[model samples]
Target: MKTDDAVSALGALANEHRLAVFRLLVQAGPEGRAAGVIAEKLDLPASSLSFHLAHLTRAGLILQRRESRSLIYSADFVAMNDLVGFLTENCCGGASCAPAAQAASKKRRAS
Candidate 1:
């Protein structure tokens, strides 16, 4: 993704509610969740949730679709991965750092 796109996605996730919504959608996976379910799970008012969802949608970080009466929302994994790739493209100088970081992550997870 371009830097501007990554910046927009980062800005969208910068808010607490938006970040929570994005993470929740990511956990939900590509199958996604209904708007009502998201509001209930996040304990957010419909209006508040709608606002945050709109922001995320505009940022291209999430996608929304209509399923009968409910609106389903899912994280845009390609965009998310792109943003992560952009952020870590030069991590610790380059490719060599990734193996060490992966090892550390694996060790932490094992513990």
Candidate 2:
């Protein structure tokens, strides 16, 4: 994930409803949730859910498929991992000073 791609993904998630939908889909896992279920769970209208889903889809944060007449949505974990990688790639200035490295150090100490 390049900086531009990461920025776009982050920008798409900046909305309240979009963030809620993303979180819900992440919890739903690979099986995903139906559009109706998402709407009900979030107390949103179908149209509103559709709008958020479209945003997430365009951001490559989620995938949608047609299961019979229903639309199923799931998080795109690969894309998510890439985004995280991009954000942390330069952590600690290529040294071991980053928080992530520090967390790993603590784990080793605890052991």
Candidate number with greatest lDDT: 1
Question: Which residue ranges in model 1 land beyond 4 Å of their true spot?
Answer: 98-111
lDDT per residue for candidate 1 within 1-111, as digits (tens), equals 898998899999999999999999999999999999999999999999999999999999999999998899999999999999999888887557868888999999999
Q: TM-score for every candidate vs. truth?
A: 0.86, 0.84
lDDT of 2 at 54: 92
TM-score of 2: 0.84
Best by TM-score: 1
Residue 25's lDDT within candidate 1 is 98
Off by over 4 Å in 2: 97-111
Q: Note the residue pairs that clash in candidate 1.
A: none
Model 2 scores what on Cα lDDT? 0.91
lDDT tens digits, residue span 1-46, model 2: 7888899899989999999999998899999999999999999998
